[model samples]
Target: MFVLHIALQGCLRGGEVVFGLTADTGGHIRYLLDLVAASSQDVGVDRIVVATRLFHGAPGPDYAVPEERISDKVELVRLASASPAYRSKEAMHAEVESFARNLVAWIAAQPRPPDLIHAHYADAASVAGLVADRLGIPFVFTAHSLGRVKAAMLGPAAAGCPDLARRIAAEEAALARASLVIASSRDEAEVQYAGYAAYEPGRIRVLPPGSDLARFAAAEPRPQVDAAIDRFLHDPGKPTLLALARPVARKNLGALVRAYGESPELQARANLVLMAGTREDIDALDGDMAGTMREILVLIDCYDLYGRVAYPKTHRPEDVPAIYAHARARGGLFVNPALNEPFGLTLLEASAAGLPLVATDSGGPNDIVETCGNGLLVDPRAPEAIAAACLRILDEPGLYAACVAGGARAAAAYDWDRHAARYHTLLRALLAPEPPLATPRQLLVCDIDNTLVGCAAALGIFRRWRSRQAGLAFGVATGRSFHSAMAILEQQESPRPQVMITSVGSEIHHLDANGVTYTADAAWRARVSADWDRDGVRAALADLDGLVPQGSLEQRGHKLSYFGDAATAQAVRARLVRAGRRANVIHSHGRYLDVLPVAASKGTAVDHVRARYGLPERAVFVAGDSGNDVEMLRAQGHAIIVANYSDDLASQAGLTHSYVARASHARGIIEGVGHFRRMLADAG
Candidate 1:
């Protein structure tokens, strides 16, 4: 149906480039435009509207209208804020409350309000979250870059950018408030978003932003574009090293300059072409740009490289593909040396144009290199590493040829049409309301930790409430061992659950008044232990560098537990699988890893319990907070993710028939119980 997208601070549309530029008018703007353009082509999408903050006299001349039509199906609506024409996102951030209020007023006046709101970046998310709450519509967020991750990368320099703290707060609020968050890459979902407590891996869907292949497809370099390159090169025949991006401090342009200048082989073999945005005078640039420019200039002079490096004065968007083509024709290299790139859209463009790439080894480049199989990733902070990667591409003929071929082959998969279709599918599911079931026969299984025990009082309240309820049975599905689960139940003075799914679904136990006791499902246990070689698996993981064995109480016979981060967990999983053990590995909360039999999982254990009780499938409810709980959350039964669950769980994909509560612990249980009751009531 109808979708409202918010990109608060940017220059709104492609045509509005006539408006004086700001830091916000970059990749994000291009991303939204391409998304809307692609979605507009789909017959299923009724209308698409992009809402942005209106600007006045400061950045450029104020526009005459509040709305501008981009296409028959897509339109732009500019909502006026407290102040007009703020230059940067930092200024807009200060007035988000007013902007949100103004947007709400505008939406209230619409003949029919949009079905959903998708906010881009943290600033827009703050406004969208506020407005969406007020309007009772689902709010989605796409954090182009996260503040916590950026602050971590920037370190002490981050303090000088005073807005970082506020940005991190806004991001937390956004993550908590949004129905979903769109991540650009799996690394972004697993790494960048992992640090936030509210970040849910399930709620985050990684849909890489697509490149406009028609515009970026391989092409012959135009005469003017060729002349632009030839102007600085002593020999036009020499292969070139191309670097393109705005002159932002994080782009690490200075590092690239030094990288090329430090090595005699790189300097003598390939000319360095820096396209650091259109500039008439370097002295006229603002603070951030000016500082970066000074760094580049200092490096050039320090290395005594004058004519060897070409810093272009200006280039238009239409000239980009040809620029890549120019580099390709010369059999040159394309480099993106950003300190922390969110997603390298230009790498896609360069790949489509068949230019081999050498990018920084952080964020999106990791995915790009792995997927495209075309590039070498180097540490942007290390000049020698940068030089060495360039040399590898330049000096090795076989590697160069492979990179060129691989890039051409990989470029086709990042299609805008495919991305739009998937986006539409998710939105449509949210839009279509589910009919009420006949009764609340469904069983709701829940996880502990952040999911069920965040606030002590709420948990106590839920425990007292659960003890009194007789309509439904309950189960505990957690990564905790049976002993650990019993400790919490006993401490809380809570009623014993009918079933306990422990060790992250590796062990199943039935509970009663006597105490927690192991109750094996013979068939399920047989399936789990069929090919399991506990000793063999242990031996395989013994030499794994990062995996440290957990304490005795935390381990189980069927489940091998270890403490490790995301990368280590991945390595452990790979190693176990390669050793041919009949085990499945799960990494949860970014730290814990578990290896269980292929047939054993939280979902399967819950299913076994439901069958034992002879409960209808619809009557089953399962929940958890971290990565370990995702399989159960995605299972056929109704599910509840209690508020305060780890973000990794929320951002997980493919969750249906699940409810994420606003209240933490038992309050969350109470909230979910009420939701199910309402569903039953509506059916009657």
Candidate 2:
């Protein structure tokens, strides 16, 4: 099967990647290249294409080339966007529309479309989604680093940045739309993604990326590599504390320097060697990198750590393993004090080089440390904690020996061949076509509480009628959670639905082939997540007078529940408008209020399901009975308002096109289905 991978940030090319050439150029490049190489060996994968932006001027001419063949099975394709100059991830947004259009044109000209498009990072996901939609294919997304998590890490000031907000929106879209989401670690899959409005835990898969550490594991110290670092240190023979990362504030390199400088014991124990990205001139660097370099220099000077510290300004990619080897030869520890790391590739490199670790507790390290048992996790914010962990490892012999043993396991625990096999299986499953009989021709959706379960006798009658209907996929759309909806359906002996849209249309789940389990719909989540600002909504309504927040159970990633009346809902809407937050406010039963993403509602979700199943608008029927159901009830499809509808739903404006059923509860849904069927027959 042919697979296409899209990664738009950084200078990506075949052979000898010059990392840290740009602030955006980092580990993700290493990850994509490694993954492609591994995938090339898989027999299931016949052809592989890596798509990146084509740009010229500065940072080398390799990026200007439109295409390059890496191997017999793997090729690189670069498409030009609006800009021909290199742009950071932050600046890539402006190029998305043009990039997508050009990419679509490029794909149309190809011999055959790729079976699947794997998008890396949010900007590339945005382009992939558009391409997939137009071509009617599937795409998977891998968020190397999520924007919402980064914004939170950056603190309150990040909330006002338009670029961050846009990036977060793109991330939400990726989560909502991708056929699958690949996460590098559990922390990324569970914690980081949980913060997004489109987060669906069932749709996310934790696939730890394999590290190519054979070189590091077999590495030996070289004279040249030693001299590159030793030139800056007064005593090069001391046990080294090594930190290798891009010269950015988020790396927290300054904090590591301060930690070493503040502790006299640490200084006495080891020399600090910092290999922050290759730089020609400190003043010529970008704003963030330049500031970070200046801070590190200042801290070293302030603590009189000149002799004990070595901050190298440059190193080639091949010099990395040797540098790690040099550190291991000196019996040193590798340190990663970044505020947050998506997946620590360097940690695996350090471990393979037989260097024990002192990494930040915030992200990938938690899983890496737990898996390999080779490191101590510390809070990056605490300099004292950072220093203490390093000191503990230095002082204890048994712990150091245990750590060294554990480091041996890193190679086995993460293998590229294993990663490739699993990835191949997932892609094949996504590309598998469904049987004709399994595909639904019609959809019948109903609201649960009042429209389908108000009367026990009617439910029994409805269940009998549903069992005889062929090619009609039955489902329920309700404001309840999945378990709550399922419990009531089972207790009342309601017909098993093929789909369940729960959390007031914020989430969608489909029955598995096993018939007992359900899988969350990742695409739907990506759809409703567009332009959603969950935090902004909360902050906007934090002090709203009339609305009282609901219990913890009622709150959801894409939904916020409250106790409020019509006036309170109106007030909430006005407040959100004033705060420039986009959300959907729904008041039901004169006592409940729910706020959701603007793109989400029972109506839009039903439409999404209908379109997905290849069912025409006229082939779908919906039944509802409350204010929250207003959106879906007024949709273009055949609508039914059960006789028992509350909140004066029958008189709601724009619902005049709906059918006022004579029957109530489940009986009303049956009657409305018959009515629409008869209407269609008459039209034919």
Candidate 3:
């Protein structure tokens, strides 16, 4: 069983498999079903997501299978939406491109997320692998055929395949990042291994296609198949020969037909039955398989070998053993002459059916025939050699019997139970351990003006220009009321005052939920507004007429404040600066210059915000590009200086450590966040 090695100790949540499917016809659909069946035994795979896109004019949800059909062990997460355009040769590519975009978007929005995805081809695999990387999950790829092969075979049609190029690239990346690559045969590994980067030769193990030996072993001998065999017998009863596959040209069926036509002794004694799957479209014949099959049929008709050849309707793979048994009972040969096979799985099925075999001397077939010690191999293109091989097997009974015995013994290697076990081991190795999550208990106290957005005060230019800004301004973390301190703040410019000291140092109100929950600490703030003296420093220029006067004093929550009027406020501020008693002013709306309680700062509020969000204190950092942000800069765990930072602020604080990045504004923020994230990773 693929065990969960490192999981949230408290969160024993379920997981899903997003398996990509592009086609349902031919071996593609059966191959998917076989994998799902084998993976069901693993403990960690709780669901299977059939990641699909509609194609061939089929309506989907039509492409998606329901959760119930995938057994009780798997729930299906169908990620589908608006599809891309197709059919028009020039526009098929544009359509697929649109589909690829929608497909990628849908995959990213998955709610629970998949634990891993099994991509059937390089195209689907690359997209799935990219999402998995972003979300920290595993992605595996199974390219049934190499990209070079598909391109050569499909020609112009291959360019329209959306994920084709990305698939090739992503497969190589997934190889480096995946826990393991399930190579169906050593031959598949050898052919593809050199194409991938840093591909460990040992990691590519020889795990052939899965098989159900017991199921095939139990198939009952059928009379329907039996009767078809009887009519083909000649004066000297010859052995029967059956070949099953999609009649695609790559299956090399025309050569088999010609070979059967050329061998008179084998032809006289036996009949050759070739069954390629049926298709709904004569137009679909323009595709590779369709065109290939048509070429073979043309050759078959050209030879005028009609009496000895037979074509059967498509049968399910599970029922193929019955065909094998009926042919073998009459001493027939099960032949497979594929040109470039990837683990001749059907041959393994033939072995389970207890049939004698004749295969070609190429690719995966060589491994099967050589391992099983079954029948002879002849050149597929040469009819004389093919006919000669078939005759030799039939004429000598001992040779045919040896092939049957060898097939039965060779079938032992591909048991599903063992395949599942190996799969489990590979999965567990990849996820053996993970970091424990930290508790959510933190806050972020922050200064609003230059600290948040680069500004002289909280409110920006529009309010400043209207002469509606305050004076004796504050630029700190407190949410203190503007009304209490507006008169004093607006004294600097010709602005009439209505706001307060409530922005930075004192107020804490949710404008949306609870309005004005906290008040400005007015009395304490006033002490810092004037001169330093023995009598606790009364506003030294308080009654000075040349200086700015307090503005209209409104009720700020519960506190009363003395705000300077326009003239008195301006006079008071200028006179104080002359007296060497400058108020720690925060020039707010360019019109108002406000003063703040020296003790309060932007860094003070950062702690509050950080704690509310359950973030760690040590994890907090602050950055600002102004002299007004000195306190917060000192308060932060890490401080950064942008290229546009206040020269005074940068000089006081030496942040020129190598960790300091050479960026400004938005770019600086981006680089800073990335640097912090990398630090966390390295610490982990």
Highest-lDDT candidate: 2
Name the regions of candidate 3 deviating beyond 4 angstroms: 1-24, 54-68, 81-112, 149-179, 195-203, 225-237, 280-286, 316-318, 378-382, 433-684
lDDT of 1: 0.77
Please list the C-alpha lDDT of all candidates, in the order they appear.
0.77, 0.88, 0.50
Model 1 ranges with Cα > 4 A deviation? 16-20, 62-65, 159-161, 433-684
List, residue by residue over 10-96, the lDDT tens digit for candidate 2.
889988888888888889999998999999998878999999999999787999999999999999999999999999888899999
The 10 consecutive residues of candidate 1 with the worst lDDT sum are: 433-442
lDDT pick, better of 1 and 2: 2
For all the candidates, what are their Cα RMSDs to the real structure? 14.3, 13.5, 29.7
| Model 2: worst 10 consecutive residues (lDDT sum) | 429-438
Error of 1 at 464 (Å): 44
* Per-residue lDDT of 415 in model 2: 78
Displacement of the residue 23 alpha carbon in candidate 1, Å: 2.0
**How would you encode candidate 3's per-residue C-alpha lDDT over 250-295 as one tens digit per residue?**
6777778878776667668788877565545544643355675677
TM of each candidate vs. truth = 0.68, 0.67, 0.53
Rank the models by TM-score, top first.
Answer: 1, 2, 3
